[model samples]
Target: MHQPGTVSSSLHEHVQIGDTLLISAPAGMFTLDTTRTNPVAFIAGGIGLTPLLSMLQTVVKQQPERSAQLVYAVRDHHFHAFAEELQQLAAQNPAISHTIFYENGTEEDIEQKHCDYVGRITEAWLQQHIPADAEVYVCGPRPFMQAMISILLRKGITMENIHYEVFGPALAFSVD
Candidate 1:
């Protein structure tokens, strides 16, 4: 996505509102099981926060008691995407919460106050925040997701408890 000549790059920089676009029917290998009431953790990085937003909204309306948490990683407070909508969703749904991790972030500030984090998320951080038994869904840049998957494995979370979506031709998963 950082590559300038790629499709993602062009879309991110050049797409305009009201512009007609063609798309295919929705498809993905992973989806949230709405009937499940177990604790859940969603880990996303940068623009990777896209997919989980809709799922969280559904939880807010239909399963207010389903415990859920979103941990998003970004370059900094100013660059964090979806902060407002996610925060609003969390506020409206008692069972939903969100945390933001800023890799090149400042000390606790107005931006950090809302999302509850201002630094890189480490294994220790995950241990303290994410429940050991919760189902975790991760979507992010390839390397970040890979690192978090490794951490989840090291923490004894089984493969069945982890869910990730493959984006395009790459093996995609979530974590920042």
Candidate 2:
């Protein structure tokens, strides 16, 4: 989380190398279905890149023939997570197409080859780049996810084809 809470802060500050923290088993419907071979587009905002990155890496290793596009949006070049891992995965897999968006990036970010784009991902850009038939997976803050869902809907993407997950309380599916 951007601002760690008490528990998270304690873990970060004092957890030892051999710490055995007990946790509940992972449970979520937001998992990727590796059975389908359709093209996939992953849209992430800030730290939301975590889950999508796992799925992207899986596709690269298991479904080598599958086409995958990762559109990652962060506050700036500094906030971009998994840069090296992403680059290595993309370099090894020709089917993986990755684009990083730096909302607060500058010419230096682009000049330094830190980001491919320097703004939020928009409807126009998605339409021009992502295939309509591609299965889309989105993970981000509530507002970012809402905007992405709205844009995907407006772009004629069915709800069944668009998948997303957000932290904290559940979000109502209403989109304006």
Candidate 3:
């Protein structure tokens, strides 16, 4: 059965990014918790912003009494997805804070007055952006997610508070 507000086509919709179009958004297990009031942190990279958008919208609608920090990583500003929407959300929600990191930019550029963070989301970066006891969610490419998980483990972050979602095919190990 097709659910209201959701497309019920076997074919995926093409989400355009600049001049590029890619299939996306069929169905997913993750959903927003409109009732959560804890300090929350989100780490996103590339096109991983889709699911985060849903959660952010839900939070805005529900108006949960919680502080949120979103750390988004991208190659550069041009390829950064949903930049304007994120900016708008941050402006609208007083409880939300944002930090953007461009891996292609130098440290000085990122540390400049208007910029957020520079380089990739390293252990030090995570430590600086996320609170020690905050509820953390990570969504990105497999390598990025793995790196974040490693950093969290090193920082002694509990598994219960850390969540992650991956897009695309699951990596498999094969013996030669």
Model 2 residue 24 lDDT score: 56
Query: Which 10-residue span in candidate 1 carries the lowest summed lDDT?
Result: 167-176
**The best candidate in terms of lDDT:** 2
Tens digits of lDDT, candidate 2, 1-176: 44633666778888999989876543336888899898999999988999999999889988999999999999996788999999999999899999999999988899998999888898899888888888899998878888888988888889888888866655566877
For candidate 3, the per-residue lDDT at 51 reads: 77
* lDDT of model number 2: 0.87
Measured by TM-score, how close is model 1 to the native structure? Answer: 0.80
Residue 78, model 2: Cα distance from true site in angstroms? 1.6
lDDT by residue (1-176, candidate 3, tens digit) is 55532442423454434555456653333555555677777888776767776677666667645788888888876677887888888888898878888888666666552347667878887877688787777787777778887787667788777777756444421211
Clashes of 1: 3
- Residue 66's C-alpha lDDT in candidate 2? 98
Q: Number of backbone collisions per candidate, in order? A: 3, 0, 0
The runs of at least 3 residues in candidate 2 whose Cα sits more than 4 Å from the true structure, single-residue gaps closed, are 1-7, 10-28
Q: State how far residue 78 of model 1 sits from its true place (Å).
A: 3.1
Model 2 TM-score, all chains together: 0.86
TM-score of each: 0.80, 0.86, 0.72
In model 1, the runs with Cα more than 4 Å from the true position are 1-6, 11-28, 108-115, 170-176
